[model samples]
Target: MKRESKLEFRLTYDDSKEIEAIVCIIPGGAEDMNSYIYIDDYLTRNYKVAVININYHCIGNRPHLGSSFYLDDIDKFILDTSLKAINLKCINVYDINSYENLNNTFIKIDQEIQKLKLNQQLHQNYKLKTHVSFLPFKNEYQN
Candidate 1:
């Protein structure tokens, strides 16, 4: 059975300045976005980064055929669409420690955040260079 899916997310950022980067928190197993509040809070409160808590496909075990959560093509589509929303040339950090594990790591989120925070200088001045093969892509593909 196929179910309609939408990119559900919670974007949290401190409006003190232009957002430096975006942190994506993806929960695993039957956990919902709420389960990663600690990570979200730590990112936004401590750093000048915007945190996007993504409720990826099959979260909370709504419905599925397999015994466990499998990364489907649709899941990639949803994740791609979600990240594409931000046009800024900022660093994107994906926290997938709890992506597909039934018994995922919790403390890893904190550790990872700390690591990224410490390495901010490495990417702080980085800029993305875009080369256009043809004209800019049409916006009609957006739903």
Candidate 2:
């Protein structure tokens, strides 16, 4: 039998200025085999946003397939942090489970956020004073 892995993550963000939104990244399966990968600090610095990636592991490679704690825990975090959105409404939660998918989603979300406002560059990366852009992406293939 395989042993469960420990939980860990790296959170990078700007607290000086209120960013547009907060991104919640919850990795499924093993903590070592992460499901997301942040490219650079461009999004956080330029956009003034917060990024949180929580990682945990079970006894199997596909722990998410048999457990609900990952989603459930992240959901609770969403609800708790939802109030942090001072400018906009609430936070944006991207339920991603793959590195490639996370990269694509980050770019798309960053591009979209930049397009949403006319003034893209505001004090480096400060875009909107609203809130974090919470985009929950569901894998259509999942049943």
lDDT of each: 0.51, 0.46
Off by over 4 Å in 2: 1-6, 28-37, 59-143
**How well does model 2 score by local distance difference test?**
0.46
Give the Cα-based TM-score of candidate 1 against the true structure. 0.39
Write the residue-wise lDDT of candidate 1 on 1-143 in tens digits.
34355557998888885888988888786567887888888888889899999876545343332223333345434443443443222322233322343124223333443554467732444332322111111111111
List the candidates' TM-scores in order. Answer: 0.39, 0.29
Clashing pairs in 2: 20-131, 20-132, 21-131, 21-132, 22-132, 46-125, 87-130, 88-130, 92-134
Q: Which structure among the candidates has the greatest TM-score? A: 1
lDDT of 1 at 97: 28
Question: What is candidate 2's TM-score against the reference?
Answer: 0.29
Clashing pairs in 1: none
